[model samples]
Target: MHLFRSMATLVSITGASLILVGCGQKSGQQKETITTSTDSELTTVDPSKTTAVGTFNVLNNVDEGLVRLGKDSRVEPGIATSSTVSKDGKTYTFHLRKNAKWSNGDPVTAHDFVYSWRRTLNPKTASQYGYLFSGIKNADKIQNKKAPVSSLGIKANGDYQLTVTLEQRIPYFKLLMGFPVFFPQDSKTVQKYGSQYGTSAKTQVYNGPFTLTQWTGTNLNWTLKKNPTYWDKKHVKLDNVKFNVTKDPSTGLNLFNENKLDMAQLSATQAKQMKNNKDLISRKQSSNYYIALNQKNKVFKNLKIRQAMSMIINRPMLANKVIGGGAINNDSFVSKDLAVSPKDGSDFTQDVTAPTSMGYHPAEAKQLFKQGLQEVGRKSLHFTLLNSDTYDQKQLSEYLQSALEKLPGLHVTLNNIPGRVILSRQADHQFQATVANWFADFSDPITFLNILTSTNPSNISQWKNAEYDRLIDASNNDDGGNAEARWNDMVKAQNLALKDQAIIPLYQSGEKWLVKKSVKGVIYNTAGANYNFKDASVK
Candidate 1:
């Protein structure tokens, strides 16, 4: 359920004066290549279809949106040279760069953006990301099949000029433009390939910093060659970026030791062992991990049972002892270090408080468990906890099983599967409970809070409350113009969700890595695509 987004770049430099090694080839024509590894296999290269971290990593490099999340998470112009907002803030007009072109040498125009947006909102596309276009006029109606895609409130005034009308003013609309879901599509290529489009590297086209190559329908390895047609190709330093799928931490570490990789992520245990290693670096990610209790299950339908489940786990211990590397213990769904209150510029996490029941209270939990079991008229309860097959996820599931079984008449089992399979199963509601993480798609608290809304396609837990929905709706409409009022409404909604025990928040993740000193200029953001290697170079 974790919609993977930004990853922070952790770099280790020990010397004040560093030697710069030129990675140039003898011919001075071939570009230098950098190698990296990912833990999960990519699901798709299509911007509209991708939902996993691996796919986002590739697309973030290979495709260019109207605007791109640049170094330090700042918004930078991409295909669009500049933009202007109407006085009322309901309309946006983008002026595209005339030199931008796709990999096939075709001009990238405003129509491309219009077509891509409409296609994403088309009911036939079945895009889970269409929800992101909610504020765009008629976007929600189009996605819900109530209106034609032609009415989506976006139009191409000319080859380089585009206009977008919003149903309401969206504070984060510019940031939203940087997301992969908002990237333009090559309609000709998509229609030509039909279902085969984006299934393999050969079927795709690129207009960003890199062009995907050497990726078949399924493979453990792929290459991203610099896109010569890119408008800002002069700024793209690396000749190529080679990526290999390495799910095993030991194997990734071994690769890094052998000088085969420029960067590799380390597990908590590995990171602890290498704490003194000069190459070790840690990054605090803007994400939250939690166990989503499926409300559709008869046992979980009891509020007491859900509360008991939430209280049994020691989140601080899990974050520090089990999943160390700067992981922060979190009880609220919205991650800390993400947003701030517009009224006083105070941290959002500090303004809201989860109920005390969210903390470890085994004594109270036992009493709640007893009451819950009696309410359900069950003498004993047994359920399986689903999780990813990764070493860390498996360890987390085992820890939860051990802790939850302490309750009387509770028998817990663990089921670990591949990351993709786990996501698919969760989407199908095939589990009673599962451990999941959600990375912010944007900077706002709404990025995390909106997912649990009654109508969100990403609501795997199936938890719903009328008041919660009302608060979120009010924040978007009644309080839309008032930042302070909207912030208060969101904070209230978060408290209500936690009070209902909608999901048990465990910790906010922190990425740990071993990176080569030679790799430089890599941009990591807290939102959108986590990593951007467009400016990266091996020196």
Candidate 2:
């Protein structure tokens, strides 16, 4: 998923013993509840419409896909009890659990998945994530509006069986299935509310361990109650999980100290201040923050200007001093330590060297900016830098504004807004430049590279290169099962994007949190959905 906000509050606590907390209510005892803080507000809970990590975090508990990510991100059966793959690795058949049922007591059937998938691929749905269905047969055509949605290669074999056909072998198919966007939706509930489905808590139904409630469309808080009818309800220990939106670190810290919150995300400054606190914890994320220059703007189309912008800023200082919370500088769009060489198991970052033209060089940047202005026939360059209103993003955007203005005759404006607003503006290509980030939807390099492709909906920058597209396409479809060849193709694509300055890689995102010691069994993963609290308990 493309992360428009920092997922700091989505803490990772996995594999811990499930002690009795709120497993069952005794006659007069109070129900155990865990209150947590989120920095960004969710715009929608609809799986097909979600584009933010915060919403995915919520759906990760309230919706169950064919499979679920377990401790360490292992693939575990959820709605599907088991699955089989064809000898060609191009087809998959899933056997759903007979006991699975929605909150409305309707049996979860294979037809639900077929309907959900077709709805997402429907052009009217306008799901930004439709690009993720590339490997599925006829999906590209359907998304392009060149074929009917009924031609999609997914079918319900019967009431409890589903089969999916792919145009090619998708290395991460199972991992992608665990994502919320691929989760099944009850057709009855969706049709019951029509356009209003998933707009509020009452408009949708749940099939996961938790059921969402009290979330009006635009509210700042919501509650996740343990679903009594969930298939795995016996293992759910928490009775209620309360989520509060607290954008200010100070406010969250105050609430945490007051014991009002079981977990609170800390800002970089707050993390430093609470370095010695026993409750403070830090987790690394498989996400990359970068600057996207909209090529649709004539000022950004000049290659030298893009290179000058990349060279003028100091990434190490920005990561360590401006956005620090264990954040590390990144040289490429694809995050470091995400994937490795298929042959020797060396880290992907170890194998790909950053372009020599990409490092900080203020003197060179000034000269390039002067030349670029001449080529573009402009004495001065002016643009706006869009960023989320969160504390960390504000600081990072300010740093960029100050650094970019250092160029002669360059004027930079800061447009700070909520994360949801940033996403909306970027999606419409309504901004000059924006600080954007991508969290890996699956544990693969294609997750990041595909988003930058010319035809991908997520490529808001509008940067395109035929060679780059060819390399990525070959890696996705034409590698012929040669692991080393496929790896090399992707490596070449990453190198090309960096050399062309299509986007400026800033740093690898990390999170700092203050979680109470009693919160247990919240599974965390660097990739995929970051947190799952289905089995979580508060002691």
Q: How many clashes (backbone N, Cα, C below 3 Å) per candidate?
A: 3, 0
Q: Which portions of model 2 show Cα errors greater than 4 Å?
A: 7-30
Q: Give the top-scoring candidate (lDDT).
A: 2
Q: Write the per-residue lDDT of candidate 2 for residues 262-372, one digit (tens) a residue.
A: 677777888999999998887777888888899988889999999998899998888888888888987877777778888999888777779855688999999999999
Q: For every model shown, what is its TM-score relative to the native structure?
A: 0.94, 0.95
Q: List ranges where model 1 is wrong by over 4 Å.
A: 1-30
356 Cα displacement, candidate 1 (Å): 1.9
Cα lDDT of all candidates, in order? 0.78, 0.81
